[model samples]
Target chain A: MEKRTEPALSPLLLAMRGIVKTFGRSTAVDGIDLDVPERAFLTLLGPSGCGKTTVLRMIAGFETPDAGDMRLDNTPLADVPPERRPVNTVFQSYALFPHLTVNDNVAFSLKLRGGVVDIAARVRRALDAVHMADFGDRYPHQLSGGQQQRVAVARSIIAEPRLLLLDEPLSALDRKMRGHLQIELKALQRRLGIAFVYVTHDQEEAFALSDIVVVMNKGRIAQKADPQTIYSRPADSFVADFIGNSTLVEGRIRERHGDRATIATALGDVTAPAADGLAAGDAAMLVIRPELLSTRGEGVATFTGSVGNSVFQGERSMIEAEVAGVSLRFAAEAPLAAGTPVALWLDADRSFITRIAA
Target chain B: MTFRQRHLALPVAAAIVAGCLAPLAVLVAFSFYEVEDFELVPAFSFRAWGELAFSSTDWFLIGKAVLSGVATTVFTAILGYPVALALTRLAASGKGLAVIVLLTPLYTGEIVRIYAWRIVLGGEGLVNTLLQGVGLIDEPLKFLLFSPFTIALVLTYNNLPFMVLAIWVSAEMVDRRLIEAARDLGARPIDAFFRVIFPLTTPGLAAGSLTVFALSAGEMLTPSLLGGTSGSTAMALVDNLFGTAFDWPLASALALALLATLFLVASAMAGLLLRLKGARAVVGRV
Candidate 1:
């Protein structure tokens, strides 16, 4: 686990161009394009069966596309076999060989490549990087789920693969362990400086770990942007709703200005930060986050409604207010009881127009 | 005791075991006492044990039985593994039919199957006719029946289904995801099969081999039907001691000796299986 002295500024480590993969008659990964910047933590975020894992497998050479091309450093990946490719996968199951010790599992790729020089040393170094150096002598079953996952990560990263793909590597662990390891894995990726393409259905995990989040829906890229942009200004309704809990109220663009638009919804007219390509009269949804709405009336737009339900999360209380026959949810620090009448006010300057239907 | 209370069941089961071993215990007791006109005296003697131990005929017969058993078991395992693999890999719709087809020979009586093989290996059998039809031989082959080769073939055939069934069970228990994982980890098909599938199935292989060996060692009807005096096994020797010579003590001693030999073989194989289990643990670590 030699630390790269300087950031490796190589070109895009991998690319998927109009890739299509189908299982039975169902298209798992429809025509889509993806790019992994060198040394970047790119997470393919989607719900289950949305084909994020399929995309990672295609890049890893485990699954081939039926219609399009994949390139690793501008070279076609179609002809390369998995063993020959400079990519490795950390499977969702942590696919560690059940018959080999942790040291042996970590050393497997090195042994496969005929690296007989100080194999134990190499394994130790890799294990140490994941804080698992002492556990190398133990069997996989003897280790906890998180330990197995760390070993799986160590095993893959030991090869020093140019493109490391993780397919829901933490999905098997309990919530607390997954949370801890997500931070550690992000740190490890940064330290190793290898381009990572991670796939997960958990959007929170993806957003917390990735430098660039590619939000996918129904085998298509809803948006590919940095975590901040993906969270703050999701490109579409799917991206907004998938990335986080968002309230999409149907609306029509009433007016527009540079970087902002006024939308007239059934609830009322509200000013929303306009993304590029939005137009007047376009049917859209004002994507307001629950946290963005507040109890204090201090924004450009507001609505009055009766609170239907209120859930008190530790730091914030989420209140679902029935506005204009639609259940509009907003969050505030203060507790509000159900059936309580309140004004759902938004800091319209922060809200974005996420979706405008064709 | 109430009608619902069934403590009688345990006593009955214990009585059955004691009854079965009572004659064996008596035979063992008699083995240590000197014989006078087929009656055991109160005097303790080591003559029977010494004679049984030092007799070159006894040693040779034991050696022959062990060698034959080993050969037959090896033959069965070699032929059965492929069949087992094929059986376990069948589609769900076809698996039941395959099991039925393979178990048919097993359910058929052993003597009946031996008689069937006897006909097939006979001078005027279908095999000889087929060989003659091919013009590879001018006359029927006599060596096909009543030889050590025929004995081994019949024993292996008889034990084939058991070996195949054991291996099929192991194959069925193998985690399919491990194979896919190996492939995903960059192992080619052959490497995955040999490194993962083969080692994981070692327990079944050991079980199957031990079963085939023990059963072939004591096989009576198959050898008698297919092999005569030339390849007379230990069971036949034990039979002669009991029937022709009317030597019950010697027959019991021979039977005990055969049992001891099978026990030693089974222990050795069990040890091998344990080592394989340890290896499976190491595999898990990887």
Candidate 2:
């Protein structure tokens, strides 16, 4: 667990080009291209069965692609097995060997190599990285889920692999433990400086740790950008809806400026930020983030509707307002009673208009 | 313990003691009795035990029994492991049919199977005829039947299903993710097999070893019928002493000696296999 002295420069560590995999008649990963830079924490964010995990498995060499090529460290990964490749995966189940003690599990790869000088020292340092030094002698079943996950992470990183793939490693734990491990994982990634390819269905988890987030939908990457860009200006309507609980209204573009367009919808025309390929007549969807809608904010008046339902979360209350045969969800500081008529404000400058995904 | 389990334990315990331990106790007592006339008389004596201990022939036969058991156990383990692991990969219907097919040899009654083996392996048997007809050999092989080879081969074949079944059940319980994890942690397929698959299946291996060892070690019918010159066993000698020679004490002594020898061997095999860390992981340290 030697710490890297300098920050990782912009060198492409791995590249997957035109990777396609199909199970039976259904395509899992369809012609996807992904590039991971050195020391980059890239997360594939998608719902279940959206082929995000499939992409990670392909990179890990567990599932070979039906078509296309994968290269790691400038070497073709197609001919290399998982063991021979300088990559490892922390499985979703934390598939730790139950029979082996934590020390043995951490030292497994070193023993397999057969020429290590000091296995005990390496194992100790690896355990120390995950704060699991005292629990090396215990078996996997004796540890809790979170502790086992820490051991799994330690076991994967003991060999100092060039790239590490994690498949929902914290999904099995409680929220507090997951948050704790998320911070630890981000710090570990920064210190170790090894590129990580993580896959998770939780958007919040993906955004909390990833340097670059690749949002996927229906076996394709809908958007690959920084979390801020993905959240603010998604490539399509799918990416916006998938990343957050946003209200999408069907609209058609009326006119356009440099980065602004007027979308004619049922609630009337309003100016919003526009994505690429927007002409005067193209059909688009108005992306309204829930955070932008407020009851007491300085913004243009958007809609007047009756509140259908209101859920009071701890910080704010989420109110669903029905207007013009559409359900509009917006947040409020106080819980508005059902059937109460309310005026909602839309920060048109923050919202964007993107094409409707087929 | 739950009330149901506590109440059920007593009846099971009573049945095992009354059914099994009672017969063993009678044999132990009989081994210590001195033979009087043909009518009836019993007195404390160790003459039968002394003869059994001192006789070289008796020791040799006991050793042969142990060797036969160990050899068969080893053979069956090596052969059954692949079949059992393969069985785990099949679909449900295939597995059910395969299990039935595996147990087909046992269903054909021991005596009938022995006779059938005599026809298949005897001189001018099917194997010899086939080999000669194919011009592979000039004469029928002499050691095809009625030798130690025949005995070993038949004994291993007879007990193979049990080994396969035990190992198959154990291999089925192993999580598939562990193998992937092994590969992910820099292990080849062979390494995964040895590290994960083999270790996790030790409990099944122990169960199979005990069963095959016991069945092959004490086997009397197959060897007595198929093994010509090497057919003479301790069981046959004990039989002769009990019925033909009319010496109950010596028969009891020989029987008890054979039982003790097999018990010691089986216990050693179980202890060696089940003492593994993998076994302890599954069944807990015992």
Candidate 3:
């Protein structure tokens, strides 16, 4: 692989070095280094128990790291309590005060400051930002999940914190609402120019909203890069499997040629763009994305196989072909009949050969 | 007909009304009965009500009961909040143990607990001994026992568990995220408690207050047994009128007056508490 140049560095807003957190005997976050640039939308994406939320909590000062240093805006965050931190969170459950009206909830921080010149007007502006100005008189319980989420956003932003943290803010909503709010959140982040550290297990949500995506597994960062790099060239098998519907074929490197490597798999040897440092005889994985395989090609077929199962998804079909004791899943316009012989063409150039996950 | 969960409450409700209202009805009838030659007569009369209405002592005692109950409620509420909020931070197993420890004093009979308080608060008792040993005082505190302070102290101590338990349950029901959210929104720990934790748990505060008030207000034994001179209560007078004085009509009338006063006070307290925005948010939906 090419020696990738780091994206032009922006002034750092928050930086964490070797941050670690543990609960009892189990480690939740282990020695992770992270940086959030000013006005950057960074997302910690992982499965449950992957410590993504733990990282977010440490940033918000809710949970103190067991070890390591955290600095926000060049000041140490070790002794700064959550209340004193210039950071706010939009919790997954939208932890709005049930007793307070929408306007009061949004006006909370300003009121705590004792005297903000025009709290009501600022509250109006905050609620207006989330398009919830009319909900001022209503309590949290009176609002729907989506509306409550918008209020939570307004409540967090009214304080005008240097950074905003969102922990699965849209996970409770239905798909349509999730998509709608996803766009609104992205736009809001852009407009506010506040650094946002969002945590979610949903890969699509991460991709949709984040400028930098950090994929975590087992308390450690698996990959940190742009969405396109994370999607197209996953660091290892774990990132490849976690990010998309990519079929990983375990294999051994047959030869290494610069950025490309020939991986000897059960089906046969195939060369593809490979992760750096995979020498000959190293165990590797071939990442074959569903869209990279097709039934029609200009040249010869790569593998002849019989259809094992075909599932018809809306607007498309997922066909699994059994070839050489391996299942190759690919999406097609129409379902292929089971037991039918199918000739598949592998697009090797777009595929990735990467290291096996620990 | 199908039985719903609410249907189960009907029998209990009916039993409570019958058990409570029946005796009250008897008291009302007795208050109207005229006494003749040390024997109860069934003739209706307004003599007892007229006497009670004119008695300054009866009204003063009734007002004292209200003050005692309100004082105990306030003290318990102030003391209970810290304990209740602390209990919420305990682990699940620890919470169970804590609740058991909290209610252990109640397991002892009320009379037994009252006697125990005497041993602790008496001039030569545990508290005075400790204070003397620590050189905080040169002499055993005279006001430690058989005073208004003793009655108030014992009442607050005796009723604290109920208040703590009520508030603890409410504090536990308060989502932990709300407190965190408050802090995240720039609220200090104290701010979080006042704005989020306290408001949200007002329902519990209301419950605890009513319970502590009812339990402490009608109590005659604590004041009479521990309160020396200040121990005189309306309940004690009603008992005196019923037993030694042999004035059944007067006793019943005083008892009814005290009951009415307490009920009105309790209703007002419940109304004031439940009207708070926090309590309404919690209870209005349900």
Candidate 4:
């Protein structure tokens, strides 16, 4: 409701309502609604087969929604074919025209429409946007993977589409290359000031680029929020586990005190802030972010456990604590050896009590 | 290529070269030898070549062969592209069944197919009878089986499988995402086909065209058996000279001339198709 008062600030660019897509007998995208404000870097993030790519494809007009209404710039897009729609896509495989040169590939949309002023100049500008001006004479096969991807971006943006959809564009690149392109892509999106709907399963990529991240599971949106909220205050247990290393303890709510709930778990009575619509006697899951857990903290829900295993992950160590036959994984500053007595304290006030995803 | 790779291809390469070159050598030898009293005399002479150079009928037959090959190729390509593309969209099992249905006519020998065509296209054939029964025609269509139409129609029908199979394989290799990319980049379905799908499948088109051209150009029985009045071909003349006329020298000369003419035309067809940017991309030339 707050989004209605400030319509002038960031006008709606695209809105998809109650979208659903089914393939064969399996549902790829269940009923979901999404909105993108102008220039917003929104990403539909999920694991493989979770319908993130299908959603992107639907927006691009490659796949029609079985039931939904999509609007672009407040215009109904039900009858608009992909070619006529003011949207373009950067395909996962690049899909560069192998027969055409870089210049031709970038100028394709402009040339197809014809009568466009300064076609060559616009092509050059597009190529320059991706730092591929010097490679206009080369074909797709002559370029490296990252170079091909850059050309694909240049080609997709040459016509200056109102919205650009990227389907795992950096997925085919090497790890180091993916990181480099990720930063470049974020910068490009900012410069273009065009709304971008990106899809990826990589949590870090989503966090690094998206202004708003939509987490999905089994063809349904688990949570949609800014990256920080998605990380620090996940909406559910699945979102917590998917986005970061978070320990989820399943239990029944013993009592509710205004905005807080006391959950009775195997570990004992735990107190955390309750989610909306959650009440006493309801099945709840407590989300404890690994970063908030500490071995030494002042006055918190402390538990006694033995160190199980620790993995040194470059800058920090990921330690697992065994408490009452349940393994709770958390991060530690240093590597803790196995079979050592460990005193772990949970920051219960900083944690959340939310419903478990069905 | 590595030594092992080259070694692997060497045997087939030698076999192909030997298989093709040996026939050409025999034709050349026969062209230079004189036939006296039904006996081939080992006398090298330019008499047969000189006669062939001045014969308008021989040149006409050769020109007709070129025209036949080119026309059949054009017809099959225009007609086969849609069938090949449609075949690509079928399910796996459906495609297997479709291919069998596509090549079923081949299982029936050429003689059987020729007779079947006669039954379908003859003066009082099924088509004519149906047209008359429907009151669409006052009389039977006489030109249906014994004219240039019959020759062209029969040639196209006989060679369509080759065209469709070649182009279908090529069309299948074209990435479906490329079509989507084209559409996403502001191309209609037709525009996508012309710009993306057509260009990438040129190799298949070339292969099909070449195969159909060669097969239809060298065909003799279809024209003679069904063409009625316009059924004469260079191959028929070559057969007559070698068998009944006992004129191996002139026959060999005519055969060589026809072969050379068709080869030039085939090369021209290949050159035109492969020169497109789409073909070069597939073959990795550019």
Candidate 5:
């Protein structure tokens, strides 16, 4: 029951603390604490069933937290219903009111509140932002899938909510349309300066649109960081593997120095940057990106492998090889043909080592 | 052989449908013929039609009955919606049990249910005993039974299941996510129900209203039992034509007019409900 006019007092926009949602006997979102700073573009990124969408639902007040306190600014939102919350959601299904015109769909919130002033102007502006101004008269069935998605966005943004929760908004569109809308939505978010809490399993879309990417696994956060940090320096084995292409080699910590450590694996012994809580005899994964492994090198920490195949991707070539009967994948500029002898160079600086939890 | 099978099947199906309509068509045709010794004559005249059109008393009585039927239909809808809502809100297992209970009265003969109501609403019935025990009244209230109100109450109870079922079916078809979406759009729980839930279920409500209207219009059992002499319905008038007066032509005329009016009202109700349902689907698709 806080004052609605005091928007400045609660500038965080949305703060979800220790959110836990359980369906039947199983937990869908476990002990999640998330915050979206005012006007920040935050993406909840994960594979399917990782509870990213559940987190978005909790923020939008669609799902109640079993044990958590959500706040809009400094005000506790636990008791506030979804409709009363200053948050709007773009559902995965688009969920545009089928009976109303596109203009009516966008103006729905305004109509719900029984206010008539300037609805047309606001709806037009919202449609223009999404580059769908002329679609105001069209019914949803008449429009294409991409147009429906844009109309869904327009409907949400027309109300000017403090936080806009997008649940895989672009996933239903074609790839090219998805890419185009991603740029437009990003630009629109920046222009409006409204907080956008986007949820998606697509890593590329998350990386493209998010100021901060929250990677989730089994209803818990794997890592939360900027796109570059999450890509380059993932917190654990799961984060590293889930984010990008990496050669995860199982090994044991052989030695640890002040800032450097070396692990012994089936591939070879390689020195890597020191990770916290690393001890001798502890099982760890040496996460090395494909491009970090070179095709030809003779070094102290190098593996001699026969390249089985090379995939000629436009930017880089992916070489799959066997080193000591262990399959290792690496990327290089030059394509190596099948059954070719190759020496793979391992770079310690680019490789992140983390203790694997059993 | 296939053509022969089609020919046989189609004719037989058409005969079955025609068999259903033959009784009403015979009544319409009989309205133009004069009755002699309980047998209809082959010759036709405009005399019965003229009598039906000019008889102001019959028109007044039929109009009153129609007005009462409409009122009872509305009453049934109002009473049925809450029960349907409560039923829909129940757990799946509970819903199954509830549906069984709601349909129990429908399975038993209408005579049995009317008698059961008579026991409940009678002079020395459950209601009288309860009122006497509570000392709310010194005597059993005669107003409770044998009145238009009694007939309306009976008609509503008789038609309650159809209304409830119609509303429940529509209510269940509503996408739950839409309610959540409305809430996410800053609608209060009450607002969400009014804007999303109720509007979406309107087709069901309209359907229920139409069902109750049709059932109440053709109701004979309840009016004959509970409506007494003063609160007679259109069906009671038709029954009297065939019974006490033996006025076959007048009864046929009244039956035809009643059937036509019921058809028009039912069609109008269905058309309006369909338009609303279509509008809901259109809005929901996006």
Candidate 6:
């Protein structure tokens, strides 16, 4: 029922109010409101089947909302077809037309306009933007997945739409390729100054590319904030759990003062910055980020526990320590053996205490 | 030795050579042999060739066969595209039902279908009767049956299934996202069809054209029975020469000529369709 939107800083490019979409009996998008500022990089981030993509589809005019009002540049988008809308999408699959060469694929919209005198020059520039100008003659099948993805971006951007929608554009690429394209896409968004609404389940991708991140769950937005705020001060347990390698300990608030609360958990009572409106005896969760826990600290140890599991990652190891029947996960530079006695210190001042999501 | 797929094709290839090429070789020999008094002979001569080469009537009939095949192919393709694309849009279960519905007419014997068509298109048949009842016509339309129209209509109806099925299979293989991408890139529905859907399905169209062309070109019974004055086909003449007339040499020459012309036309049709960028993009990669 609450509309969660930041005050418009730049000119608003797109605004959706109370948008809802359903397929047969199951609802894909619950009533939700969203806003995109001009030249903003906004990301709809969630797990699969979280209605992020449905929202993107609604914006691209691929899926009509069942009950909602959507406007772009102060014009209602209800009657505009996808082709007529000044919007384009970079599909998740990169859906490059197989029959056309890369040059023709990028020139598709211009050709449809009939007698665009500078189509070839514009196509060259679009392809050059994606570093794919040399592949003008290549067919879609002739190119690799990443190359196809680049061509897809070139095609969508060639028309210079007012808004661009991307549905997990980098998901199909290898990890290294995904990282490369993420940097490229963010740079492209900045250079073009076109508003971008990107949908992805990868938290790191969302954080890396977006100025505003919308976390969705069960066809509704769980949280909408800047990525740093979302990471350090998650609105609820769901946002905290979904974002990073964090341990959520079930607890109840014992006292609240100003912006801090002391929550009683199985381990012990700890004071931390908490979400607003948390009174005593209210159910809450202590979000222990991996960075907040250390084996060596200046103060006295918070808990004495034994290392339960340590997975050796390339640069660091993810270590889980068992204390009071709770598996507390944290990262360590070196792998620790199981059953090794470890004394862990909790930086409760920086940890977040937030309400449990319904 | 390890067996491969090409090796498996050996026996089928042998059977075809034995069943098809050997008979063609025999026809080549028979075309040169002179027939005397309806008696068996093996003497080679140019008499049959000379007669066929000079007969304008035979040439006209052969030209008519080519035109008929091309017309039927074009008609079926024009009508089949929408049905095939519609079939692709159906749900999986609905598609199964649609396929059965499309092919249900084919389940009836061709002769039965021809008679059913006669009942629908004849002077006193369903269409004419309905038209008369509606006062659209003063007399039954004579062109309804026992005309070239009847033959073409019947041929298109009979061959529509094959064309639709071929295109439906191809259309089903096309990723739906491409069409969405086209629309997102500012292509209208009609533009998407011409620029994306139509080009991508050319391989299917080529296949369907070849099949319909072959089926309608060499057909004899349909034209002979349903095509009254316009019913004289090269096939019928060949049949007459081989059976009632007993001019085996001339019959062999005419049949071989018809086969050559049809083969050339089919090849050209296939070549033109397959040469499209869309077809090459699909088939070349595969």
- Tens digit of per-residue lDDT, candidate 5, span A48-97: 99899888888877678899888887788888777778889999989876
lDDT of 1: 0.81
Please provide, for model 1 over B213-233, each residue's C-alpha lDDT reduced to its tens digit, 9 standing for 90 to 100: 888877877777788665766
Report lDDT per candidate: 0.81, 0.90, 0.94, 0.92, 0.82, 0.93
Backbone clashes under 3 angstroms, per model: 12, 0, 0, 0, 11, 0
What's the TM-score of chain A alone for every prediction? 0.94, 0.96, 0.97, 0.95, 0.92, 0.97
How well does candidate 1 reproduce the true complex, by DockQ? 0.30
In Å, candidate 5's interface RMSD is 3.1
Candidate 1 lDDT at A39 equals 92
Ranking of models by DockQ: 4, 3, 6, 2, 5, 1
Residue runs of model 5 more than 4 Å from their true location after superposition: A1-11, A297-301, A308-317, A332-338, B1-17, B85-94, B277-286
Question: What digit string (tens of lDDT, one per residue) describes model 5 on residues B158-197?
Answer: 8889989988988787777777777776677787777677
State in Å the error of residue B112, model 5: 1.0
The DockQ-based CAPRI class assigned to model 5 is acceptable
Listed in order, the DockQ scores are 0.30, 0.67, 0.76, 0.92, 0.47, 0.74
Candidate 4 lDDT tens digits, A1-358:
1334437878889989999999999999999899999999999998999999999988888889999899887888888899999999999999999999999999999989989999999999999999999999998999999999999999999889999999999999999999999999999999999999999999999999999999999999999999998887777888888877788889999999998989998788988888877888999888888877889877654888899989999889999989998788888878998989988888888888888888
User: Local error of candidate 2 at B232, Å?
Assistant: 2.4
Give one digit per residue, the lDDT tens place, for model 6 in A78-111.
9999999999999999999998999999999999
Off by over 4 Å in 1: A1-10, A60-67, A73-81, A252-264, A271-283, A299-301, A356-358, B1-20, B30-51, B76-94, B119-147, B184-186, B228-230, B277-286
For DockQ, candidate 1 versus 3, the one ahead is 3
Q: Write the per-residue lDDT of candidate 4 for residues B1-286, one digit (tens) a residue.
A: 9989999999999999999999988989989999787799988899899999999999999999989999999999999999999999999999999999999988999999899999999888999999999999998999999899999999999999999999999999999999999999999999999999999999999999999999999999999999998999999999999999999989999999999899888899899999999999997668
